[model samples]
Target chain A: MAELTYRDAVIRGIAQEMTRDPDVVFIGEDIGKAGGVFKATVGLYDQFGPVRVRDTPISEQAILGAAMGAAMTGLKPIAEIMFSDFIAVCFDYIANEFPKSRYMSNGQVKCPLVVRTGNGGGARFGAQHSQSVENWCMMIPGLKVVAPSSPRDVIGLMAAAVRDPDPVIFFEHKSLYATKGEVPDGEIVDTLGSAKIVRPGKDATILALALMVPRALAAAEKLKSEHGIDCEVIDVRSLVPLDTKTILGSLARTHRLFTVEENPRLCGWGAELVSIAADEAFYDLDGPPVRITTPHIPLPAADLLEDIALPSVERIAERVQRSLQS
Target chain B: MAKLEDRAPAPKGSLNDDIGEEKRLALYRTQVVIREAEQRAYDLFLQNLVKGTSHLSLGQEAVAAGFAGAMRPGDLSFCTYRGHAHTLARGVPIVQVLGELMGRDIGLMRGKGGSMHLTSVEHGVMGSYAIIGAHLPIACGAAWRAQYKGAKDVSVCFFGDGTTNIGAFHEALNFAAVWKLPVVFVCENNLYMEYTPISDVTAVKHPAADRAASYGLPRIVIDGNDADVVYRAAIEAYDKARAGGGPSLIECMTYRYSGHSRADPAKYRPEGELERWKERDPIKLYRERLRAFGVGEDAILRIDAEVKREVDEATEQCKAAAPPALDILTTDVYADGGFAWRN
Candidate 1:
């Protein structure tokens, strides 16, 4: 076993997949000679040469469009958009073309493409560079959205996305890149569309994703040690093909639920989770569901405002407490 | 108008007696096949036998026939919504296309993709998209794959004058030029993008062909009505792309005889536009050109009769087909079984 940061695990996962399959390649800005802006693709261009680790022009549309074409023709492409916000420029290629290709062709074609983007607010990079848009992608039907909160989950989920026959949006929380964790040395494959229970408890459940997972864990520990509120934490790894079964099962046992997301409340991923739980496990709910999400406004540039804009461990705990009271 | 003797060397290869009469006749026959198929489709639509709107390629048969003929079996093709001629030229069975228009289960897309979404992966026709300039990026993607894999195959992206103004068109062209990917952008400039003429919408002097020079890619403007001219240009473009000479854009200056979709009657067209385009009708020009090249009258009649019969047979097969079952609506959304069924 090796101790790897979430970013390092992603790089290793892509490198392994590229070495295993010649069809697998990486494309992004600064990924070639510069090793990516975040250095996640360091030393790949030299090892794989220019063909596999392409240094594309600054156009996000070009990077994504090339990946889509490559995926359609018979290559497993992992394209990295420097930041999640840059995806806005290529949304047409993603929402209109990639997802609709297979269905439009009646299963005659499959886009085995992976779009890896870094998101989440915490870094001093301000609003544009640090925003979570996983909810935007989750709204699309043909896409599979995966958000891994740990090094192990990132590596495993990335490998799965590379092998998946459909297009997948693999979101990496930029704030969680340096966070180290135990990652298996050998090949690890995790199932998409399934949630994993991080900590088990019967008093209440904390459903979270990506960077929010760590906050939820912190909140869970605080509730246990300080307030004596036994909390169950479930990491929702995949947002689009959400593992509702596991979430509902946890809710049934815990009888109370609170969701934490870095994105805003209105039309956010957390709202979807609440609605799903209401429809699937409403009878099991002991109280109305609560959500700890960023306010419905653009991420603030100021440090204090940024802190206020993001959901905190304290906020998650407060929501969990509120859920228990209801 | 200039006489035949005054014309230039016809681009590259000469259309002389050295080229066999049979080959020229075969090319004409292909054009006739597309024209007859589209005419029959229009007739069916008028009679309400086919449901949904269709953007007819009535005046642009040569562009599809010529380009598809130049492509190898493995070469990829991405076309716009006005793509019936392109699909038929790429060898999708006429019956399946007709069935799709009729909304039958046996349609090309199993009745999921209607008139605008005809796809036949078997023939390397990736699919046709209704979005104006969307397919250009996708075509670039396919071409990148071909080049990366060290394959000789090339991708042909066909769009219209309307699409050239969109952001995707410029983005795709720049990427294709920078990477030197093996792609050919075939812009079927039918003068108008639906109701708006190219002159009205574009600020550039020559539209797509002129824009190619700005991107440093080779451009060729051809009389789209002349099948032989269109065929020669396609051969040159395809050869350049396959030889790893990067990308080329061919502007087939053609016209549409129908409205943009099924609903409009094309009443907004200019007074003399239809008459001017009719003078350059591709089917008639090709038929006349074939006759001038010594294709006998009897052979031309035989080709016409054969194509008409084929279209009639396809229409009959389409009418006999059934609509897709209600359950089929949910399938094919995702490769893996993950979508929720609300019903």
Candidate 2:
């Protein structure tokens, strides 16, 4: 086992796929020689050269449009949007173009591509740059949305996303890039739409994704020791093809549900999960599902303000502990 | 009347002679088929057989015919919702095009895509994007793919005058120019942007041609009503792109006979505008040109008669075809052939 940062795992995952298939190409702004703005794609350009690892102008529409075009023809391209917030700039390609290509063409077109964007907050990049907008992509019907919390899951899920015969929105949290975890050597291929039970417990079920997964895990430990509540924490990795089986099974055992989210509270991904559980597993629930999320407001830039705005371990632990007691 | 040389982009060139009689006759036939098919499509729309809405390329057949004729078999063609002509020009069956317009099971996309998004990968008709300026970058990507694979095929993207103002148009042009991708952007400057004249809202007199300099591309404009002129221009652009000359932007001055869509009566059109453009009808000009070129009258008559028969047959087949099956509602939503989001 080797320890890898979440950022390095991104490079390894892309390199692994590009090495396996010559058809895989990468395109984005400053992603070639500059190694991306965040240094996530540090070594791809030197390895693949300019033809495969292309640097594009600051044109989001062109980046995704070209990617869609390439994918439609023959190439399996991995496009980067720099920041997930900028996905709004080229939302037409995400919302209308690639997603609708297959259905509109009656399966004559297949968009086997991945759009990797730096997502989430706590870095104090201000309102426009620091929003956790995974919910924005998840709401789109034809897109597969995945956000990995740990370094190991990052490589595994990214490999799965690239190999899938569809367009996937891979959201890498800006905060989690420096986080480290042990990844097994050699190939690490994982499945999409599968959730991992990070902390197994029977008292109550706590669900989270991306950065919130670790926070949820930490909160679960605190709740178990301090509040005498052994909570089951599941990392909901893929939002589109959600792992409802594991979540619902956990809910059945614990008879209580809680969702930790980094996105604004309105129409968050957790709301959909809560609705699904309410409808399908209403009898299995002991009380109304509780959601611990950032309030519906623009993310602040101040260190204290941003840190408090985002759901932290203390906030999640307190909320779950209080909700379960009530 | 004035000679073809007087109006062509290359006023003094021997390139016209190289087009050959065989290709000229084929281009004429393609324009005739597009013209006949468009008229039948209008007729069906009038009878309420073509449901929803359609954007017709009534007077823009030459642009589709010329470009599609110039493209190789594996070469890709991307255009806007005004795409029936482009689809047929790429050799997609008239019956399937009509079937799609009428929302039939035998349509190009089996009625799922309806009239706007006509696509036939087998025929190299990539897609008909309804959104303006959206497919320009997509065509660049296709060209980039060919360049990556070291292939010689070029991607030809077509759009109307209104598309020039969209951000994607500028982004795609600059992107293609910077990357030196093998693609040709054809702007069918029909002088109108929906109901308003394109000149009214556009900064320059010529929307696409004038903006070519901004992207470091040559400004090549031609008379779109002349199929021979458009054909030669397309060949030149495609040849340059195939020879690793990078992207080229050619603005073809054509006109649309119908409104922006079936919903508009085109009341915004100035008086005598439609009549003035009709004088230079592509089919009429091509027929006269074919006669002038000494193509026998019998051959021209045969193509016209055959095209008329084909349109009638396609119309009948479309009328008899049924609506798509209900089970198709959930199919093709994902690559897995199922719409299930959770399991």
Top candidate by lDDT: 2
List ranges where model 1 is wrong by over 4 Å.
B1-19, B337-343
The first chain of model 1 has a TM-score of 0.98
Error of 2 at B39 (Å): 1.1
| Best candidate (score: TM-score) | 2
The digit string of per-residue lDDT tens for model 2 on A172-277 reads: 9999999999999999999999999999999899999999998999998999889889999999999989999999999999999999999999999999999999
Error of 2 at A178 (Å): 0.4
lDDT of each: 0.84, 0.92
DockQ, prediction 1: 0.60
Error of 2 at A300 (Å): 1.0
Q: Lowest-lDDT window of 10 residues in candidate 1 chain A?
A: A317-326
Q: Estimate candidate 1's alpha-carbon lDDT, on a 0 to 1 scale.
A: 0.84
Mind sharing the TM-score for model 2?
A: 0.98
Error of 1 at A12 (Å): 0.7
Model 2: lDDT of residue A215: 93
